[model samples]
Target: MAPIAAHPVRSAARTTLHTVTVAAAPDAVYRLVADVSEWPQVFGPTVHVDVLQEAPEEGGEQLLRIWATANGQVRNWTSRRVLDPAARTVTFRQVVSAAPVASMGGAWRIAPEGDGSRVELLHDYRAVDDDPAAEALIEQAVDRNSTAELDALKKTAELGADRAALHFSFHDSVRVDGDAADVFAFLDRADLWPERLPHVARLDLREDVVDGQPVVQHMDMDTRSPDGSTHNTTSIRVSFPDRRTLVYKQLRVPAAMTGHTGRWTVEPAAGTDGAWEVTSWHTVTLDPEGVRALLGPDATLADARAKVRHALGANSSTTLRHAKEFAEARAAGAPDGAGAEGARATT
Candidate 1:
């Protein structure tokens, strides 16, 4: 690959900065900044990150390619970052600019406060051209991203390390002798979830389009709890139609979890040759305090973990089974019956 052409930095280059203090440890705040992979879950704008290289330095610095949605637009870039654990700081310089952005660099600082920590996020940037319009756009993006990241970081850090008490990852899959497209369609049409899935009591969905194609889908869900109550949460989903995968991260998780993310993927079943399999891969980070409140003082982290796993698994498994039956029925050219009421009625 060729090196990126150097764009001359202008004397009028701008800078944007923001800071906040939170009830969390300095190291805890530092980890959230130093680890770029977790940004998708902790920050609002970041959608994904791929590490291109890792430098064997004192603080585990690295080069990364990141994709993010900012100011209602999706963009990506390559960046080099250096971490300094002792100083609780991470500095970064963007090597590849997505568009009007010529160059961008910033630093994140975590300092000790009385019984808490102070976080400062800074950004200095330049535009590729001297157009005032381009500069304004870049500044808007910088301000939006920095503020959202810091706010999220404060919330996650304040949740504390104890939040990881019940963190776990698991996946479940079911094979169906039906069309892959049909199964994917069933998963993508989440608005019908309330009708199709007995546990999903209500679902509110909104889609955002880019260049006439749907890119992101945001959903607010109310699911039936074991005691006939309802649990509400919000999520942002990215759909890959060609790949038949829907990746999602919770924006508002249940009280028992600090973070939750997962993907629903469909592909041709192996060796079975004619079958398709849909899988739900899920991972959750728990909040210990919330667990105590929900499970009671006597409940251990193990118990909380078990409860969460069973609850999540049961919902996903049931959805997959329903999709399987629906797709198979469609493939067999069967007449619409009570089993298809939920899907058919929605359309």
Candidate 2:
């Protein structure tokens, strides 16, 4: 018999480079990119980020788990990053990639540009089985997300002295005399919000599931504000059921805000059985022009801050209280009438 022929393996890696000029110091811009925890607030496509393992030394590598929107869908992956503060560079490679992505790597390079800085984002990726369709999808996603991230970085960095005034975070919590799981269920099943939550006028929810378990959710909701006005918003949510936590970022924000991200957590109350603490947290970046228009020209940042805190806090407190009632009702083997209009009236 003739010798069998052998096929050579094909190399499929493709590289892309994107750059932006920012009106900030190189080190400052580098720090924004290096700090993964803030990516959810700083990047439009980022939903959440968790640091799985920290570096042993200042410039060593660290492990990170990240969830971000790709082509309007949420996906998660783990990456290893090496930080070089001296050089103002951060390099990363995906340790575990989601479907259609075989491997991925990237680097952020920040260098001096006159009085400001030039930021370069580079990516190298390969599709699973070198599939052309998957490769194109990945390319499109990278292009869209990279542009958004760079633009946001530039805008945030240029805020200069006003960044602190423009951004803020707060949380509201309630003690629920019930099981943590029941409290989490009340939050996780947001599809029932229009029925359960008085502030929710209308809601549409879609979930992406794997193996009969929901991993991500997209929500479009119309909410009634304290002023008797209705606002429509859309958001992407990532759920961690094991931790009884749900994190989300709004894609369509109100006129008075540029960005909004939030989390809902249900945990066991310390030293208390059959009791849990349910909290709602919000982080927002204000639009100065929007704030002026919405609150009148005389409104200052402080005024806008106070208005947002009060409005958001009221809604969150109402939700937490309702969730408390729902959980306690279920725990006590009482009929689940927590979503009744009478129950909402009490809130």
Candidate 3:
């Protein structure tokens, strides 16, 4: 299983599955189950968990205190737990010999539910005393107690207010008249991007994978107007070529602004009048912080759309000019840019 959080809470049908929403994160819920020592603070005289031995690896050994009342009779027991944190599942075996547990195991799961989380508990039960009726009742008690644990954990996690979420994509795209392979040859060159793109001044390679694709590209972008003022931002980009998307996150920016993200893309589109057209779009998102007036903070979605439109227009115009120069030079057949220096002759 990828994680227990993906599954819904379903104790055996003979048992119960009670869910009481708490104000906490899934991680907080996991902590509640993993750390039994803290139960005394939450449920005095009612619950206790003690870690007997912890193996360095996941699914290691654990010991927990077991005490409860099932039929007006006080039962004291102990369990040996094997916990797999990766799966968030625990299998408990009766260790105290005297404990009436035949088979007991359950899982603490965390799942996403809108802006909050759903904590689930999956439990299994069997009777050591050969009493099926007792097993059913025991399941009910376990479900109730596990649900309460999740509720407490949630309440604690929600104490921390919600944090902002951001998603973005950006990279100036250069297209050529040739097929994908030819266009990729030029566009994939990192050095060509900094010089050709007006905003990208430098791309510092942070780490390169086996195929030499950069896992992290420390970039220095230019936000300078024609008037000379600069607003430089450093961003980290994680790229997936198969998806044709590059996500950009702003690591640093001017002191005045907040919540910045931008994306650049190249998509082939048919021209309004004729000819195949490729549009390059760039979007930037901004959110204001430290200002609480009334309503939720505003964003830069509109401004970002406008910026993408402008960039596309400028790039199409520039591309047209460059194509004209290349075609004319190729026609002349003088080894285009043969006599010229610092020339990038595109065929």
Candidate 4:
């Protein structure tokens, strides 16, 4: 999947701006992020915090009592955290049930940066009290806490890659050269075999909503080898027709084979000569046995990554080749009075 863009949840008033560069990889930094208890470990203060409440549902609400010191000022605030993993985003507020002196909330973004990674954190906070004299003190603390929090995260991600590996993800999209309607038509034909591509035995369109927005389409597919060995699994398929993108979350896979959530994005077609050509991408989690197992036990890490990319890239190329052929062929056969010249390929 592709990484998320910058997500900053800060005070609309711009009262708090804690920005810093971390010397760490995105995964390593996310470790501390996924769990807020690690705050005291990295920050000098944040001596303690207690959860006041937790909702019964996923991405539910949690009330917190945070005690910390920043820039020579000691401040305590009660806040709430709203977890939204499906969206790869989280929201925060000052209170869950009971109000407090201030509210704190933010969003996190993790992305690949060269051999390591980059993580950006943006959070907004406000002081609830009317202590006019305490505003500056609270502002300084906010700045200090936010900066230190990120620094500690960097210390962990950049230098901790060898100690413990961490992983967080952002959804990605692969582009197809054709227009949005054309892409949707091809995907609508998932029941067709690996004729358009390999490892796909079928496509099941679960629901066709007249609402005209993309919804989840549960899929059943069969992946077979030349020897007739075949594997089948159920996947959750979701697409954004307006964006010409599709995402697949693998649910069930046969033994000996592995798969997970992956976004098969179809970007707006682009070409040097202004011809529509699909640009595709494949993003997946690391295989269970790690890169070594994927590329053979003797292969190095770099080799494993390169080999995996080559393999997936090859698969993408094949699919694109087939999609191009399908679109071009469909366009070539002029239907009597059909809107061929007026055909719109704008995703």
Best candidate (score: lDDT): 2
| Deviation of model 1 at 105, angstroms | 4.1
Report the error of model 3 at residue 70, Å.
Answer: 4.9
TM-score of candidate 2 against the unseen true structure: 0.94
All-Cα superposition RMSD per candidate: 6.7, 3.9, 20.1, 17.1
> Any runs in candidate 4 off by more than 4 Å, and if so which?
1-180, 193-199, 202-205, 208-214, 224-233, 252-261, 265-274, 288-296, 334-347
Model 1 stretches astray by more than 4 angstroms = 1-11, 18-34, 44-47, 50-120, 126-164, 335-347
What lDDT does model 2 reach?
A: 0.88
* Cα lDDT listed for each candidate: 0.82, 0.88, 0.46, 0.52
> For residue 115, what is the lDDT in candidate 3?
60
Clashes of each: 0, 0, 8, 19
Query: Which portions of model 2 show Cα errors greater than 4 Å?
Result: 337-347
133-180 per-residue lDDT for model 3 (tens digits): 766667656765565555546644554443222113343344334332
Clash pairs (backbone) in predicted model 1: none
CA error at residue 318 for candidate 3, angstroms: 88
